[model samples]
Target: MPAFVGAIKINDISGSAVVNIGDVFHIEPRSQTKTFAGAGSFNTGNYLRVKNGYSVTHTVDADNVDNSNIGNT
Candidate 1:
């Protein structure tokens, strides 16, 4: 089926957002990735002693797709 959209209000779209209007057969092409680094704390001014251990890691699953072709005509 189809639809009738009224006057739209202008706002903002995030890094990952989708907007669709009227009828559509399908929608494709979407991706996401997240990565981080270690964080620590330190102070200086006169003398300070501290010991800390903070780490961050990232991993990709074997089932993840990369450099591949999908969908069909």
Candidate 2:
């Protein structure tokens, strides 16, 4: 098993796993990913550090936005 922070609720399909606000997901010393999950809002960031031998799949709520400043701004 792996270590995780924040909440992971069962039957909650519309959310990202293994990430939370102000928390940095470090895949390795040189690489890392961070996520900020806001309430009633969906904020997410996925940094691919390993660059190899890694795979992930998740469902995000439509209400969630990766970031407000990017893409739209």
Model 1 agreement with the true structure over 1-73: per-residue lDDT tens digits: 6689889875997766667777888775465454444443335566665666765555545776544434522
Highest-scoring model, lDDT: 1
Give the TM-score of each candidate.
0.35, 0.14
Across 22-47, the per-residue lDDT of candidate 2 in tens digits comes to 54555223223455433323434686
Model 1 lDDT-worst window of ten: 34-43
For candidate 1, the TM-score is 0.35
**What C-alpha lDDT, on a 0 to 100 scale, does residue 27 get in candidate 2?**
29
What residue runs in model 1 are displaced by over 4 Å at the alpha carbon? 34-73
